[model samples]
Target: MNETHAIAGVPMRWVGPLRMSGNVASTETEVPLATYESPLWPSVRRGAKLSMMVENGISATLVDDRMTRSVLVKADDAHNAYLAALDVAAQLEELRAIVRKCSRFTELVALRHEITANLLFLRFEFTTGDASGHNMATLAADALLTHILQSVPGITYGSISGNYCTDKKATAINGILGRGKNVVTELLLPRDVVHRYLHTSAAAIAELNVNKNLIGTLLAGGIRSANAHYANMLLAFYLATGQDAANIVEGSQGVTVAEDRDGDLYFSCTLPNLIVGSVGNGKGLDFVEENLTRLGCRAEREPGENARRLAVIAAATVLCGELSLLAAQTNPGELMRAHVHLERKSTSTTVGGW
Candidate 1:
């Protein structure tokens, strides 16, 4: 285990295990949600003060966008691309069945192809249940590739992973096509609540988003993302919940948008690559299991439901932390002061200007 330092005083709050339902690929399971404690809960609490329900929707796609490995096959002739493509299309049912034989929880979602010179890359997307499904997807891909070589005509085997899957890396395709649990969490903060709790107007938060997140990102040449410190929340949540910490690479590639709706603040965080599961290697560990149980995610449910619930809660936690940090940074000295007091070893009240 890497060094685990307790970043104390990061106030945690339980917002929802609220009734959330939608077209999620995984079985629908609602897990009680909690977030890493933060000192900015007062602002977060104000936003949550109003009677509001957080609605979460999940869409399951079978491409282990995090660990998807593609097969690059070179056809003897360039014209064979059409034949190979047609043959692949024809064998869709067989491929699906092949995946079933290989793994119980995985389903073949779609087969995609790309052609370059004489090489053809066959990309498969599958709905891997509960777990992140990285190894499951790769294993299924190998079985299908073996069949393609023996039956398909005029083609030679290529590398197993063609880099098209873009696993564990930041790329444009992950956002455009999507990767893990595509989670969107949204809330509308009442005008009075905004001022009472967040101590800032909706207009101020919206303006900060534009100047800091949107325009500032463009000025700094950031590609395909606009946010201040999503990684901060994601890393903390991942560690607490026993997620693959490395997956944060693509997981952090997301956008936060705030709009002033008349007098209220409409805030949303869209995470295209949130790869979390309730049942996995690290989840069985003592502390991790206890954490999952605390969040109400440890209950036995259908195969994929637990994982889906975990993903939704994770997205919500991220929204809470993101909103708090953004609000704190809006003030001049609050951000540095909070870090110095909550994160620093020395009990110094002042750091540079804190």
Candidate 2:
């Protein structure tokens, strides 16, 4: 079959010379976002502008980094399943050796398993250098599966992925155990800065966060997520940087925290599953390459440094947008007015029959 491909264009913009400092990266740089939501550019810019007003700006920390894949096997019986899990767990060094053969960058860092009714689910976690490690983790898992089936008695292959890895879906396991780069970004805005740039008081944004993000999400049965439109910023950043856009599924599963610290605003966004890489499947694209370079993610560094830098930037961007949106919601007409003005080219419209 002959196949033709076409380019789908997304409006791209550089939103900030955002000030960031952390263990991974300490640089003030403009980040690129490709999106159809024109309002996002200004909203995020507002947040970035606030970041600069603070003394330390945004402090992003890389808490953990790993990629995961799970493989399923069937045992002769429930007893056999338990035994097989024990046997595989004992072979950690051997499994690590097999992973090394798959790729120099792939290292088997940890293993976990669950057994039910003669079925075994083996979760393999890896440290993949400078890549998101989706394919790399799968390759390592495949090799380990082959070795396990041969050595461990009473077990046969079932399938490669058993959903325990929980790729591209909002699952509680991903948030609890984590997948990809885990980053926590924080900013402390003075009461005056909050009032000046956000046009909202610290107490107001903090109250809205509890009512809307925390309580509202809980009542709605959201799984391990509480935030306003984290997916929006993540999708835009992922697309601009040539990341696997679909990773935004698990990527958006993050939490936002706000506090009125004696009249100052203490805001944070914790992204436990930010799956991004500076070099990967989409990195070959000219635009993606350029964006990564401009974001300072393509520089030669230690084995996982580039990806870590990208993850922190992505988290900071999330915090910026999250902060801005929460602040806007503190006012009755601000959000709708801005949307109408930016998206519809008009600012005069009744909001909720006002």
Candidate 3:
């Protein structure tokens, strides 16, 4: 068995895919590539660097800093609903200020509502600082709920979680209205690179995307996303980085678009629900912190900026894995053969035609 250790000048331990010279291993190859290069290529291991960063641009509209929650309240009647809505609106400024007072790292960004017969679903969005902001949003909501229960007349508390905030589960609301980090990563791979590295042509990859991801997903009634194994890459990255792994349900809700631009292959992954944070929760772990630091996501420049960087890098990594897998699927039995060779520990050699 080969010894696995940390790469020099980097934080990640050698899980697989070391660049070898002669019979001896020297340096560790990075992820995704390692997914193909290592003997454990079928098992997979995977990140952000300048080549990825070049394709990413952080949304300037305070996008990464925002978190949203929906609270349901029962009113006596429609008139009471309208009155309660008015009261909520009237206290918007006060609530914004109250969020700051209630939570040290949260800021109220916006509050909107929907009124039904006697139900009021008030949605609140916030800037949650270097955290993923689910708890921060809930904390702010609790504070706001307390204030509303005290101030609004003829209203009763319904639920702190009304599904309007749309946590964990996949929903159209997250795709349309946006949730967590909205990242779109694109790459224009050269025809030579496409054929040599990916082992497929641009046109073939684009056609496979249309038929497999788009039409196939529609036939299967997929919810809000049409892609190949996005959750696979997201889950791996989330585990390595200490993110809330459950968020992958919504985090994988995205669109994968492929096009043959001239002779080059144009591939992109637009993910709207990527909830990642550089600080808080599991980041305190020694390995997690080391990974974050190596990714250059532990920036001290601003509060939520490091999380934004992490999100983009994640999106880029998703793009790489997605591209590679789709290309592999173009050839018959290539994917399974890799799995048999790397994943299976059996002595039998005929599996998957290997």
Candidate 4:
């Protein structure tokens, strides 16, 4: 472990006994239908391995002892968290454009509403680097959005009620999930739910479980996209880091789903409310300061619209990472081959240009 390692475990190599476990908490308490898939894990492992090499190489350059090698690690939770963050980050530009239009209409109606909250509340997809991009995108959006609100027809009615430098609110629109983030595969138990769960806690509600006999029989089982896992993990990371967790309701989404060879589950996560800031009262919150440091996020990244950029970065992180995972499992040794191929292709393309 390096001096910068924040996660409890040192080396992220090997899950030891990678068997499917019971389940993560779900607010929907209906018939518990389980989903299945096997696309995300291998790619995530591949990325983590690459990061490990980087960290180890950096450490080895400084010290001669093999035992002294170390690097910041990406665990299973962190893996999912980072991927979801990336997906959310990529949607920043689209969200910005949409919010600008939405605010004009919502505010012009003269109703006692603020686009501030709604504008900041968003959904997008991207991938994360080795670490969770929760703080990264939140800070990115917080910085980027102020300009959007300021440039518009006076964003007098959005959720960003507070301000840092710009007139935008100190509280950003909350967010969840990233692109290509991986998670367990499973079907929602209820099988049919049209009502939008405004609150993030709705997933844990028993009525959504669908596993209660008659309803349970109607429940469907299959695989989900890693996006769902990324969405939930990002939410969990946000909650742990003192972010506005409620945004998960508005900004969260599960992007893709499909069945595995075993026909179990497939799912993905999508979220919009990536409300976060680089500097805030929460900086003093327990362990949040430390967590930020672990993720390598810094204050410079927090500014007008900076949050949006970081959000995009988070999504990109997940995208690249999930691709990495998918490549590894479907073809064993493919990960190594890809790295080599990418290098060779880059070289060939560069020489061809000359």
In terms of lDDT, the poorest run of 10 residues in model 1 is 25-34
TM-score leader: 2
Question: Tens digits of per-residue lDDT for model 2 on 70-187?
Answer: 9999988899999999999999999999999999899999999999999999999999999999999999998999999899999999999999998999999999999999999999
Error of 2 at 245 (Å): 0.8
Candidate 3 stretches greater than 4 Å from native: 1-65, 345-354
- What would the per-residue lDDT of candidate 4 be over residues 1-354, giving only the tens digit for each residue? 657735332111121111111121111110100112212223333322322222121010000000000011121343443443344355555544543353221111000111121232222222222222443334434443454444433223233222221111112222112121222222221112111111112232222222321243235332221232344333444443445554444334323232232221221223233344334444565466655454434435422223332233233223223323332323346445544544543433111011
The best candidate by lDDT is 2
How far off is residue 323 in model 1, in Å? 0.9
Predicted structure 4: lDDT? 0.29
lDDT of 3 by residue, 181-223 (tens): 8877666667876766566789999999999999999999988
Report model 3's TM-score to 2 decimal places.
Answer: 0.81
Quality of model 2 by C-alpha lDDT: 0.91
TM-scores of the models, in the order given: 0.81, 0.97, 0.81, 0.29
Off by over 4 Å in 4: 1-226, 254-272, 313-354
Better of 1 and 2 by lDDT: 2
Give Cα-based local distance difference scores for all models.
0.69, 0.91, 0.72, 0.29
Q: What is the lDDT of residue 324 in candidate 4?
A: 36
Candidate 1 matches the true fold with a TM-score of 0.81
Candidate 4, position 83, lDDT: 43
Rank by lDDT (best first): 2, 3, 1, 4
What does the lDDT come to for candidate 3? 0.72
